[model samples]
Target: MLRSTGSSALNFGEAQGANTDKDYINKASISLKEFKESRVNLKILSKVDYGNASRRVELLDELEQLIRIIATIIKNKK
Candidate 1:
């Protein structure tokens, strides 16, 4: 999900025009939604002892960072 959003932003950077910006913003927004959903699911899994607690914490932290980064990109594009 992070890679997809990053790729969309990178492609926008390589292109020239307003349309690219809108496209990137749209794609990144969708990716952001999915990332958020994943975060929710991760939280649920953690409650059930689906993985190492430490590792789950690490992943949740990383996912939050990615979400913020993608949100920043979308904001700046607008």
Candidate 2:
């Protein structure tokens, strides 16, 4: 899950310099999928008693905000 988030951040960083709007949107979409994976993993961790539930929930909230921001970027891309 850490690897997933790290790689997604890297992908998003690369997307920052995309040569075209379409390319940026495509890469951002991939990052969004990866973020979703992390979100699900966090839920699993909570269900299995793997971590502090409160902290995990907080992380989920942060991830949700990030997902929304990325989705909005994709939606408004021209």
Candidate 3:
């Protein structure tokens, strides 16, 4: 999932034209949505199991940060 986001960001950076930038932006947007869904699923899983809760929390935090970064990128691009 992170890989997809990174790939999209890289492609966006390397884009040669406005059309290419829009395409990569859409890809990044989709990746953001998927990441958000994964965050929700992780939250549910954590609620179901107390073991490794701290690690799960850390991951959730990282995912949220990534989401924010991607959102900012998309906003600035538009």
Model 3 poorest ten-residue lDDT run: 9-18
Which prediction has the highest lDDT against the true structure? 2
Model 2 CA lDDT for position 17: 88
TM-score of 2: 0.95
Once superposed on the true structure, which residue ranges of model 3 sit more than 4 Å away at CA? 1-19
Better structure of 1 and 2 per lDDT: 2
Which candidate model has the greater TM-score, 1 or 3? 1
Candidate 2 lDDT over 6-72, as tens digits, reads 8789889988989999999989999999999999988889889897888988999999999999999
Candidates' TM-scores? 0.74, 0.95, 0.72
**Which residue pairs overlap in candidate 3's backbone?**
none
Give the alpha carbon lDDT tens digit for every residue of 1-78 in model 3. 345445545544544344666776776677677667767777777978855888888888988997898789788878
Q: Estimate candidate 1's RMSD in Å.
A: 4.6
Model 2 Cα displacement at 56 (Å)? 0.3
How many residue pairs clash (N, CA or C atoms closer than 3 angstroms) in each of the candidate models, in the order given? 0, 0, 0
Flag regions of model 2 displaced more than 4 Å. none
What is the model-wide C-alpha lDDT for candidate 3? 0.70
Better structure of 1 and 2 per TM-score: 2
Q: Whole-model Cα lDDT per candidate? A: 0.71, 0.91, 0.70
- For model 3 the local lDDT of residue 50 reads 52
Scored against the true structure, residue 39 in model 1 reaches a CA lDDT of 82
